[model samples]
Target: MRVVRGREFVADRAWGAEDIASMNGVSTRLHWTDQPYKWHVNDGEEVFVVLDGKVEMFFRENGEEASVTLGVGDIFYASVGTEHVAHPVGEARILVVEKEGSV
Candidate 1:
């Protein structure tokens, strides 16, 4: 069991993360970042959830780039082979669920 005051959480630096859980090959983590993540495709599916603050999610589909703004409570699903990146709108807290070792 774990308890976190998510809204009050802050990262040590850009892209800092707190491990939440890992079971049956799936892992869950809470991340804090003020900078942007590098664009990359996951080896498997991924679930991106915003717990606090705001974020801009950028993705490439069919060689065309697109983006979306995500606020608290928003969820982004990344399927296999989907290339995407995340840019925090200041400082943001995010929850990520993905296969172990998938970045």
Candidate 2:
């Protein structure tokens, strides 16, 4: 068990993550970012939750690019084959849930 104060969380580097848990084949993690993440598609679905600060989420849908601003408590769901990336407004903390070893 662990306790993370999201408001006080500082990223080790851009898009850095702290492993939280892995059960069966799924994993949960906490991520901190001060920059934009690389665009990629996950092997499985992804659940992204903003824990602190703000974020600009971008995704590719039907060959078109779109984006949205996410605040604290906002959740983003990326289904399999969904190409997406995240841009933190500043320093932000996020929770990610997905299949183990997926990228």
Per-model TM-score versus the true fold: 0.96, 0.94
Q: After superposition, how far is residue 90 of candidate 1 from its true place, in Å?
A: 0.5
lDDT of 2 at 63: 100
**47-75 in candidate 1: lDDT tens per residue?**
99999999999999999999999999999
Candidate closest to the true structure, highest TM-score: 1
lDDT of 1: 0.93
TM-score, predicted candidate 2 vs. hidden true structure:
0.94
Tally clashing residue pairs in candidate 2. Answer: 0
Per-candidate alpha-carbon RMSD to the true structure: 0.8, 1.0
- Candidate 2 lDDT: 0.91
lDDT for position 62 in model 2: 100
Tens digits of per-residue lDDT for model 2, 7-85: 7767678878888889989999899889999999999999999999899999999999999999999999999999999
* Model 1 ranges with Cα > 4 A deviation: none
